[model samples]
Target: MISQATIDTVFETARVEEVIGDFVHLKRAGSNFKGLSPFSDERSPSFMVSPAKGIWKDFSSGKGGNSVAFLMEHSHFTYPEAIRFLAKKYNIEIEETEQSDEDKLNTDVRESMYLVSEFAKKYFHDILLNSEEGKAIGLSYFKERGFTSDTIKKFSLGYSPETWDAFTKEALGKGYKMEFLESTGLTIAREDRPFDRFKSRVMFPIQSMSGRVLGFGGRILTNDKKSAKYLNSPESDIYHKSKVLYGIFQAKQSIAKLNNCFLVEGYTDVIQFNQAGIENVVASSGTALTPDQIRLINRLTKNITVLFDGDAAGLRASVRGIDLILEEGMNVKVCAFPDGEDPDSFARKTSYDDLVAYLDTNAKDFIQFKASLLMNDAKNDPVKKADLIRDMVTSISKIPDRIQREIYIQECSRIMDISEQVLTSTLAQLVQKDITEVGKKVKQDQKAFEVVKNESPVQGAKVDVLYRLERKIIEILLLYGNKTEEFEDVFLKTNEDGEIENVIERKEYKVYQRVYLSLQEDEVELANPLFRDIFNDLIQYFLQNENLEIEKYLMHLNSDFAQEVTDILMEDERVVLHNWEGQNIIPKTKSETIGQYVSETILTMRWYLVDKIIDELKNSVSNEPGSDNTESMSMAMDYYKLINSFSKKLGRVMSRYS
Candidate 1:
């Protein structure tokens, strides 16, 4: 268990924007920060962070909370893990009770795999730095590649021994479970014997955005005829090759700061670029680029420059990657090294200044590079050139912006010496064809989901009205609970003529007190479980403290309650009242008439509850034709009158049935 002092220190030291910004590229939006939602694929930004309240909300995924909560949601860290991450990031020393070895066995499966992977990384790295065999083999290999000791340790380059079962024996001897070892692909278990997976190899640990080791990539040292040169950890619960990008954990901050990411092919290319003073670089690890991986970079930048080897044959796959980045609405540039040179080899030989200058001069717009590369093979052949134009048009259509597409098409027309009109026409046809295909796919998907599986036709929207009203009541109490306001008290009593008439008395009470007294008068409770808990807790907070400590309250709220609070607090931010005041359509802010707003919300909730009760009473009488329901009927009539009174308070025009 982490001590309260440590958790508080972490929370105080770790700024919400700083913690989230390490992974997300944030831009100022009014007083808050906005960025693309990390939880969902989106072009427009829907994620918001408010430093004043120390909370964040992702409208796309409906997940919202403070800094620690963001870590938990984005990286799937447990609460203690999140706190520890924050502590480490903020340089705060933590005090916590260490978990016994017995407690480790009951950990989550994914966590166990993560622990094993981390241990493997440490063990291999130690061997490389300390062991004679490792120094002679793995250390020598990295040294021959021109890597310094600092560079070697920065990437955590490690060595695995030649013996098949060396790592497995050590892991088992340390009381590590074989279940996690085999599951993480660190040790391959066979019926006869368990062996190390990467024998005679150099290790590169793959990490998540928060620097947690997810897996490893090992490069074989010896040129064995049968074995592959490079081997990666198999897809496990924590590591998916398609979703993981090599060096992302190291490159994220630099990419976000520079506003561009350098895309390379292999692990060495990334390390070499970083060693050359270019830190914003990552590799696909020789796998085809994936949308998921692109999105990981997308969260940090809107620009990517692909660094290609001199081989034109390999350029085809990188061209496909360019199309993917364009489809994601990002600006892409391509640069290729001279013949017989890749980023790794070139960066190793060239000075940092020369490498930077070369990259700047060689980088070309993606569309131009693609057309010129393809044009080389299609030269002097009208038939082949025409095919090239169509292919270029298809790539252009992947662009989401019309202005950008038009610009690229004009560039393509100039480069190909073709008419602008012809390229534009071809582009339009391809775009229309894509739309038609999408429509057909949507219809097909609808047909596939035609089968109904529910036992009853329950309309979720039917109950939302009351739930919203209850939620609104909580919102009002939370925002204005400590504020004292004048409220009109209604009473039905005899007048001078001895006739029952409505009498109104105005009284001063705190917003929380009024809500509590009103609800207590008729026994009303919030319908939504989350809203109910928040409402009671918020009332208690207002009662105990004069000043609202929103951050303190947030410390105890689960993501669900925090989401509700953020939706309530930040909903007004989403409402754009742009230029409405100029047109004499000024909106009334709740702060100005908060008392009235609170009363109206409470009245609306009461009215909804009374109406539901009246309906239930009516249904009961209607279902029993032979029995008399005089008591229930009288109770429903009273409820109807109460509804009328509440409707009047809420300024709703409902005809009185009584």
Candidate 2:
């Protein structure tokens, strides 16, 4: 864990513009900056940033937050990765909090392995571009493969020298620890000797989503019969082959923008497609496609186009894994090149326009592609045809959307001449069989789903209302909590004549004090979990701590919570800065009449909760034993009267002249 003090320093020192400006092209839009959303394809700008508030909002995507949140969303970085990135950007020294011994060791080991991997990527890439042997062997191989110098450099293509311990000796000479070198599989350590794992091979660095080199795929240049044609880094703490895709680092942005992914089967396929100007492509690296890898793409886009060789046998084998994609509720299509060519060779030979047009025209939805390819031999064989239809229905059942499954079933009916009723019956049977196999677990899930399906809209609206009210409480505390101001407290007392009346008295209190004491008097607690957590933290800070700085307060919070707080603090500013900055838009500010604003907000919240309690009492009083309990009815009437009193108080507090 990063120490709180260090996190505070980093947040304070890192400028939101300077950090995000590196990734997004921000243009001046009144008091804020506007840009196209990085998360979606857009013609006009919907992404807004307010420098004054140190926050941003992507209107197109409904994602808004502080600087770290931007990095986390755009780059797929974890919380620690995002913080460390900001810390590095602002030149802040990191201070780690105390951890368990085991945790410390594990963290250190992964960091070390990552460091070694990064070092090896740079070293091999430098050798490929600069060294004599590397240029003659590795650079020549890439150039011969129709890769431009820019493409080679862009992908960080490299060459490991063809000698034992060549990379190991240099890494050690540079003070790189032997433990990390061997752990990352850059250097294989033996009892008698150490050797480079990728000697005499064209090196392709496999990077994490944030572009950190995790491992390598090395292709041998020579025809050494005993040596494997291609080798990969052995699995280690930092690299898990099943969970990552090649070229994801370079392809993520394009994949998101285009809303589709082209999954290929080799490193050269990815590289060549990117060079041919279609950058949203990756490779399975000849392994069976894993759910983890599909999920990696799922983070960016829901559409996948699996590119394959034209060989029918290869397509048949590969189409089986397309079910995993459908199981994830993703749309899938299959595209293959002409006979005797893969993505690499075809892309290497075709023009960019031709390559794109071919993909656009040849791409077929997975079901259509599967049925067409398999229906050939089954046309004359009735039993095989029945089995094929069942197989198609199985794939259809993997689709989570009922409408999509039905649409594909219709398409299959047209292609295979099978009736929709038959196909639908088959799918139901498969689904029921799955439920039977899952047994108790699925029954519980079905019950949960039914509960969700049965929830009323009014109940949902009440939850939304409560959510907004809780957010408002946090907004008040964060903005005006420490400021002392005049407040009017209304007391309802019975007069000497036994008539109800309101006595208004003026007093001075800090905003936090007024809100906290009011809630305390009413015995009210926030319902939403995040808002509740922030409320308690604000209470402790305002009541106990002396120094009150909003930036420091924001900096000390967890990033996820900080984004939520930043949203609450800046939601109004987003509108003010974007549309009303110079239009004489004099929206209400907490700084003016802060006391009444706080009182009204708190009263409004209490009024709703009181009203809710009255409704619940109505239910309780109308149900169960007595069915006409006077005491419950009296309590309900009292709450109803309280709501009326709250209504009058809110009206008085809200009227500016009062």
Candidate 3:
């Protein structure tokens, strides 16, 4: 177990914005940073990071927390794993007890796969640097491709021996489970026995954004007719090839700093470009460009430049990729190398300065690239040219931004020597068609949601009342709990004549203290299990810590419960937090009215409870007419009168019968 002191140190040292900024491109909005939600597919910025509060909220996904929680949620790290990640990032020395054998046996499957993959990466790297066959073949091949030792090491390039089952035997000997080894595709398990899958191949370790080894891509040295040239790790729990970009773990910082991404096709292309002094480059790793991969890049940069080989296939891939990038609401530019030169070969042959200059000069907007590339094929053929025009319009229609679509249309019209009016009309037609399709999909989705809602066990105001009140109470605690406020206390005292007298006293106390005392006095607790737990935690924290770190509280919360709190806290952003001061609206701002708000919310909660009790009592009296229910009836009437008086004080109408 990690020591509490170490955990506290990690929390203190890790900055939420700094940690999240590694994966997300955050821009300052007011005192907080805002970006596209990393948890959801979104075009607009709804993800917020408050450095002052040391917390982040993704309004789209309803996930919020501090640095550690963000890491856990985004990377799917366990609590301990997240703590370790933060500790490592912040250079904090960890204090932990040695795990027993049972702990090793009970390690999670995904983490086990990660461990195996990491070990395989190290093993292969050692073989490449130290083994004779690896040096003769793998090291020689990389060196021949103009990769320096530093470059090879930076990308974790490695090699597997020619002998079958060599890696398998070593891995199994090391006590690493064969199940994980096979699952990560390092060793392929057959009916008879398991052998190395990437035999005699140079290895490229594909790492996740957080630099954990997810899988590998291996390139074969020998040109055997029967063997595939390139083999990648099969889909596993930790590695989704479609979602993993080859150089993302390396390129993330550069891409964020540059505010742009350089997209290439092959692993070598990415490595060579980084070697050539261009660091903000990644590859699709030979797969078709996927939305998941695009979203990954989108988190780091809004601008992407596709570097293509001057081959038909490369051009086709660029065309296919541009729409996906545009659909993500990103700016895309396309640049192609001279014929017979891919990015890998070109970067290797050209000087860094010359290559950079070439890319800058040759890169064209996607529209221009598409129009220019297809114009030749459509030349002097009216029919083919018209089809090309429609194709360009279709591409433009895929763009989510209206201004971008219009600008691209204008550029296409000017370049193709076509009328702006005609292009605009065609673009409108394409956009209308898209809207029609989207409308149908939305309607279908709404219908499905309605069906599900109708079938759900919990529905309507009966469910809403308890949850809304519970959530509101938590939100109050989260937002105003630490503030000192004046509260009016009401009590009963014995007068000099031995008669009961109503006594009112005003006192200043912290919001949390007042809320706690009020709830304690009334013997009330939150009904929802999650909210109740959070409420108890909040009270415990307040009692224990003199310095209340709301962010720390959120970070230490269970992931699911934290998300619910986030949803409640962020809900105000969707509505008016303060009452509008016009016509019949109150002039008090949220800060000025918070005391009243808290009081009203508490009273409303009590009123609801009282109403529920009254209903229960009435039901009891009606069911057991033979029994003596005079006391229950009197109790119900007393609750009714109490709730009515409370509601009147809050300026709310109470229907005792209803």
Candidate 4:
């Protein structure tokens, strides 16, 4: 268990922008920083980081919270893991209490896998630098590839010795469990014994965006025909190769800074470019390009320049990848090296300035690249030319932006010497076909709403009224609970003639004090259990502390409660940032009218409670036998009149019961 003091220290020391910037690139927008949503695929920036509030929000996905919440959401880190990550980043020392046996038993399997992967990374690295066979073979191979000592260390390059159980034996000796080792694919568990998975191979640790080791990709040094050249770790709970891009952890900062990412093909390609002083580069680790990987890069930048080797196969793969990038609404360019040269070789051969200049001058927009490449195959063949035109239109249609699609269509028409009407008509037909297919799927899969037939209408209505008012009260408390404001407290007294009179007293109190005291005086509690618990916590915490930090308070909450609070707090802010007002749609800005809002909400809740009691009384009179109900009716009528008068004074209609 982590101590409270340490958690507080982590929250205090960690900067929201700095922690998030390590993963997503954030640019200044007014007082906050705006960037592409790391949680979803988006071209225009929708993710926001507010340093003043110590929180961040991804408008696209509706996920928002403080620094700890961001880390947990983005990296899928456990609460403890996120706290530790922030603490380490801010250089704060963690004070932990000893875990009980039950706590040890409750450790998450995914976290265990992560621990094993991290341990393997260190073990392999140490073997490469310290062991005899590792130094002579793995280190030598890296040197031959022109990798510097610093580059090797920066990437955490390592080696697994040739002995079958070398790594497995050492890891076991250090008290690492076999289940985690097997799960991470570090050790292949056999019926009789286990062995290392990457024996005699030089290792490249594949890290997540937050720099945690997820898995490894090892390269075989020998030219044995029976063995594959490269082997990657099997997919586990922590590592999904299709969703991860190599070198993302190292390249994210530079990618955000430059507003572009250079996509390459292998681990060596990424390292070589970094060695050449180009830091904004990542590799697909030799897999076919995937939407998940593109979305990962989309978080940092919208512009992707794919670098291809002179090989025709690689160029073809680059062409196929262009459509995927377009589908995600990202701008893509293609850059190919000279004949027979790949990124790794080319980066080594060319100087830093020359390589960068070459890329800038040689990079072509995907539309142009696709047209030029296909034209060569369609030369002097009418049927082939028609096919080429159809292919270009298909790629163009993948673009989500209508203006971009129209522009590309115009360019394609000019290049292919076809009429604009012909290309536009073809594109329209394709789009309609797509829409029809999607409509069919939706119709087939759609579900009807299930209605509960057994619920009582009157009871349901009562609960709904109370739920809405209770929720509004909680919202008001969360937003304005710390503010000091004047409230008009209304008290009713009966005269000797049994007529009711109103007594209004003005009092100055903090919003928290007002809410707590009112609820206590009325012996009322919230209807929703979650809201009730949160409200109680808010009141108690306010009483104990002079100041309240919403973000810090959120850190101590469980995931569900934290998410609930974040959603409520960020909803209005998102609406404001989305420019709803500019569109002639005005939303209530709570801060400016908080005093009136709080008083009205509180009074409305009280009115609702009184109305509910009156309803129960009316129901009782209708269902009972002959009895003296005059006193009950008179009291109900008096309460109704008093609430109606209060509503009139507040300038609001009593809409609930009516």
RMSD of each: 4.6, 8.7, 4.8, 3.7
TM-score per model over all chains: 0.85, 0.71, 0.84, 0.89
- Note the residue pairs that clash in candidate 3: none
Q: Candidate 2 residues 347-421, lDDT tens each? A: 999999999999999999887888878889698999999888888889999988889988998998888887889
Which candidate, 3 or 4, would have the higher lDDT against the true structure? Answer: 4
Candidate 4 residue pairs that clash: none
Error of model 4, residue 110, in angstroms? 2.0
* Number of colliding residue pairs in each model: 0, 0, 0, 0
Output the lDDT of residue 562, model 2. 76
lDDT for each candidate structure: 0.86, 0.83, 0.86, 0.87
Model 3 alpha-carbon drift over 4 Å, by segment: 1-5, 190-193, 449-469, 479-486, 490-505, 527-529, 544-548, 551-560, 569-658
TM-score-best of 1 and 3: 1
RMSD after Cα superposition, model 2: 8.7
Best by lDDT: 4
lDDT of residue 73 for candidate 4: 87
TM-score for model 3? 0.84
Model 3 agreement with the true structure over 411-527: per-residue lDDT tens digits: 988988999999999988888988999999999999999999889877557558878888888888888888888877888999999999889898898889888988998999888
lDDT of 1 by residue, 269-316 (tens): 999999999999999999999999999999999999999999988887
Structure candidate 2, residue pairs in collision = none
Error of 4 at 126 (Å): 2.1
Count steric clashes of candidate 1: 0
